[model samples]
Target: MHTQRISGQAGQTGRRWGALAAAAALVLGAAACSGGSDGKSAGGKVELTYRIWDSTQQPAMQKIVDAFEATHPSVKVKIQLTANQEYWTKLQADATSGSAPDVFWMNGPNAQLYESNGMLLPLSDKLAANGVNLADYPSSLVSLYQHKGKQYGIPKDFDTVGLWYNKKLFDAAGVKYPDDTWTWQTVQEAARKLTDASKKQYGILAPAFGQENYYNTIFQAGGSVISADGTSSGYDQPAATAGLKFWTDLIKDGSSPSLKSMTDTFPSQFFESGKVAMYYGGSWNSSTFAKNSALKDDVDVAVLPQGTKRAVVIHGLANVAYAKTKHPDEAAALVAFLGSKQAAEIGAKESGVIPAFNNTQQAWVDATPGFHLQAFLDELPYAMPYPTSKNTSVWQTQEPITFAPAWEGKSDVGAVAQKMADLMNTALSKEK
Candidate 1:
């Protein structure tokens, strides 16, 4: 699941809706001048707007669009890029006003929200008619976009978290690099050895972020954020408390920077600046690290350290069509083509992400040979779907607030966990 926050203020909602109204007005004005709603322009060409968040994937998406345009000369695809932080808010505003993009990106966090509200077009029928099998994609990803029994989105790309370490720092501290055999105890030992107060360098950086930091540890420790039935919270359990305390203990022991320090400078920034020896990060960082001149040959990734069990949080983005789009057939066609093996190959070749298409992820591994990219794919078997309920955003928004005292060293981990559980249970109880 994407972790970027969407605007939650009531006033921001009005402003966003106003912005959507203005955008819709512009589109309507243009359409009135052109005089067509069947994807046909005044020039007799079919025009469709495709929206997405990641600028890194735009080149590959454009390549796929170009290929589609070449095959269907009558249809023209226009690319619309939005920053991820604002993408959901804009999409929601547009959806509320009946003017969402013909096709756009969707993630696990908001998939159910849009699908349940009838804002998304279910694609199962279209995929079947076109001879596209859902089995061609990862089963977990296929399930992620399914609400009730209808598939509302097509899997585009996926990511998993891993232990990213600086090899130079490890060598300097005489600590072995993390590997598959590493565990929680092993990491703690390494963290102790790698810390250097004189140099103001830390062994690790464990920020309060859930997906990148604690969520993986929570699962590894045999804990669940939410119960299997999605009816309750698990934070009060001992395993959950242990998972949370692991990081708090690190901060208390000075193995990592204080939470305040990390909040000021994100953990990734600290790792890139050589102030942190190890970082828990997602597979998406491989391309980013490869492009960082300062970290060119100094960084490598390892499977996350294990606890009672080994686990990673798996998630991906999917392409979904707007339910109210004027050009349903054209929009579904674009969504299917984007989720095809050919499009996945283009994404992998561009090093955009691990493609969801069956047997097509190796290109992503080979694209960045310096780091162990396969570690992410190898993690699939033990990966858990990123935790979510119908209204995941509701409780998730409360996480940092409820867990802050624990991260700040002002409260016992168990106490804070109990408070989180109480808060989350109340939220989950209302999810229906």
Candidate 2:
């Protein structure tokens, strides 16, 4: 969830929320453009706008909306697709001007910010009124969108990271394919063998991102990003340093591309193009890989290699309604329906995302054959909830900047990690 590096645009601003002046301008522009919500189309039917970031999932989302409309008939939902990197900024701008979409996708990193600011409508009372059981979703995911004991969102889908490998590269290097039994040592050995310097190919693509990279290894090494209470930082710990070294060592050994190269090309792209033999990717990439002609046949996923233990960062997206929506009842109804088992199944069948509703994920697995989709579900037992705090974006945005030297091999991991801890602690201290 560390401001996904997939598109590389996230790193361009340095701050996920733009500067004060830019944000003010956005607020002014939004206010000038804002119109009070009508919540009804010219046909007198309730109309709601829904926004989300993943264009890959838009078709499936439309299917969900169609299903919802079938039952209510009076409610119409329009889907708005925004790029991930710009989602939060636009949401903030719209939120400030009381013109945010009636319902929008919310993630762990920004949920607290919106909830605390009273921009999000709490769904607890409505969920209870509808007899919707929170237990149907992952406990961690449910907790993620809750602020001060009030649930502001309903989990839509979830994902976990895995080690994705190219079978052809493993075969050519005479290295065994990665499996549940593989460990850090096994990965290093395989990486060294699979790396082909002459061809500009590396064994793996270890970018300096969190969710798809170091965060999992850090947890696997018995280290955490923050304390259980969310009051302090954990980066300075020895275990944390060891986890970071896992990727830094790969960079040092020429088994992965330099941070500079990864900046130019995302790790997922490198894997898809066969420039890297393996990649630490999230379950969300399943649809992408299935659609990529170059990688569909050769790519497969496995459990992430264990360090001191096995761990994966689990995160999800939730559906939250804007607090100021004129059609509060309609928005709440739409959110409830979207979080229902039926909607979850639709999402799983079409989007290939692990539906948050329990017992509904098999559809996603069955949607794509030949790849081990179960590997993501298998990680649930040891999975760590993606790290979050009230001001997650504040500290998270500092990661690439503070750790650049270490990731680029210009500074020692321990030293850089200590600095990160200091900066993170400073950020945490400012949050209520």
Candidate 3:
């Protein structure tokens, strides 16, 4: 649920990151103003700035910071909360001006951009020296922040997609609730039955989204977004064509609302307001749904239905330290502590996010009762990591533009997919 774009309340990734320019010059220019180790006060007190974009998660993050401060008596950590829309821009400006935070949140779309430019401090050696074990976190998450075989961020939390349905709608349609046994055919059938054109009620909310929609299906259909070596695009593959068509077919069949309608009003809003019966969203939505008094009681989630196979896209936020931080030791210490089981436990009990630390996910499931939150955790075994490359944002920005015609029912999905493949390949070829 972490990206560099307009991160929603569910912490879902956004798709709008600009390619960084003059990164090396920004790094060197920041060294003198980073305050260096000599800036410590006479009392030897160190102040470290930790920044994050999601205000919903600030309370839990603050608790983690407090715990770290408790153990490291001389360090005072300040939390900087910025809106997602401005987070990356502000970070970029700060980096260029030598005023970036000591540590901050990092996501898949921008990780390589910052890491490859030497903007983020490598955590492998420090984590090992601090007795922190990367094995404690999800492997997919651990690998997400790695650039050129070195880790730059510590895995914080993870989220996977699920199928959320309204019991009231299913009951009205006399359709059985979805479960692990459900397949693509099962969903299509149910969607057709539940949809009522007269009532303006769609069976499902299928937006032209990656992690929440096509990415999972692409993997389930045995296709991938990028090749293993990150040098090619998979959009032209037959499997990818099938995956892309899944949503377009729904639009064409009148089972899902038109892409324009879904775009005008977010799919989540449609589901929350009862305009749609089912929604494919991330695990982060559990807390959001729980808070909405109107839909909380009637909403429940299930594993994503199978295509060729069962799959979901997994993504997470990482706690990354700035390489130019003056208090390098303190910054790394805070990062290490944040990645610990204790911090993950705090986040599980307090925050809505699923902790990346192994065995702590149950606490999150237990935290939210009645809604079968476990569906998100259950898919982890086969969940594919959210696809990324040295500059993932390059092609990510092209997805909706390239697929809009098919989504609007004005073009063939297969044809649009091939066009997308060519565009993605061109973007990949230009990467350093």
Candidate 4:
């Protein structure tokens, strides 16, 4: 689903995963799966159904498919567009019925679950035989789809977080524009100067979000969400408290809006409406902001403000094949092409996404001349992988519930952090 970037609710990472918890059981309970039979067409063309969720990227995907068919005329690829909300549910039902699509999009949150359940076709050997180089993609993204030393998918595109700001607001406040050298203190000072109570303007949106807000800070503070071995929670650590305190302090100083204000209206609305001066958002926001008439000319992005060190959260979508596909050779051929540099180049020029293939992101950067899209690429070296464990949705759904009080200013940040750690630890313990 590429984290539901194409939608207007792109900023709300919450709505994307709640329903995943319900779909988890269905995925787990499903029997060994097989793909639907969409064999040879009238002209001896072998047709394969490829499923994806983002309509915005469908055109680019179709171009990639067209290229693949140009060489392999006998094999035809059909793209099935399903909305993110219903994508997982329908895939679960299809998997249970042994009729899943031959190829489909997979995200970090669900990669381990699908791989562990044996619903995905491991492509390590197949990729090597196809002369596909894993080195072509960022190592973090490559590692996201691996399970027990097996590669389950090939990264299709990648996205990282950035510090987005309104240039007009910064100019109006007489503050210097943010740059690579900016740090936590710099953000605090700028946020203070940029905020105006009378105008209902804020410095930034310190929302109760994972990928867009606190996760990157947690990493930059030298803290982690899950233990290295993925068996424990790191939220109980002291550094995590510092990471979390960074946001709570902004609320305390009234530089940022109350969690209630953001809750009543999404944080993105505040920024897009020009009520907020700065924001922490994903690279996907590039396309969203470009379409916005109010912000198209005024909004720009920079690397996230450093805490103890510089860091950002990197996440992306991958392409995988069904384990029991009817036409294994055809499916493997399609998957291989989808991960190739040629396909990535097509997507980069047309998809408005950061293609995962190395050296291919510049097109996406140049596509949006209005913003400093390079900020997203610059943080790649220090980017942290989006955290996930087997059955990630179990703990993901609990995060907001467990941390809401702190965000709402009703409980101490440290106290609620420890509570979240305990809750996350219990959930991690239950993963198979």
TM-scores for candidates 1 onward, in order: 0.89, 0.89, 0.93, 0.95
Give one digit per residue, the lDDT tens place, for model 2 in 1-432.
223532122321111232122233344344434332566798899889998877767888899999989988998888888776677777776767677899988877767766766777888889877658999988877888888889999988888888999998888888888889999999998899999999998998878878777888899899999998889999989988998889999999999999999888766777888878988887777777888887799989999999989888888788998887878888898899899999998888877578989889998899999899999998887878878887786778778788889989999999989999999999889875
Candidate 3 C-alpha error for residue 316, in Å: 0.6
Better of 1 and 4 by lDDT: 4
Over 4 Å off in model 4, which ranges?
1-18, 22-25
Please report, in order, the local distance difference test score of every candidate based on alpha carbons: 0.78, 0.81, 0.82, 0.83
> Where is model 1 more than 4 Å wrong at Cα?
1-38
Write down the TM-score for model 3.
Answer: 0.93
Clashes of each: 0, 0, 0, 0
lDDT of 3 by residue, 138-197 (tens): 787788888888989888888888999999999999999999999888989999999999
Q: Write out the backbone clash pairs for model 1.
A: none
Off by over 4 Å in 3: 1-38
- The lowest-lDDT stretch of 10 consecutive residues in candidate 4 is 6-15
Report the CA-based lDDT of candidate 4 relative to the real structure.
Answer: 0.83
Please state every model's RMSD to the true fold in angstroms.
5.5, 3.8, 2.6, 2.2
For TM-score, the strongest prediction is 4
lDDT of 2 at 18: 29
- Cα displacement (angstroms), candidate 1, residue 322, comes to 0.8
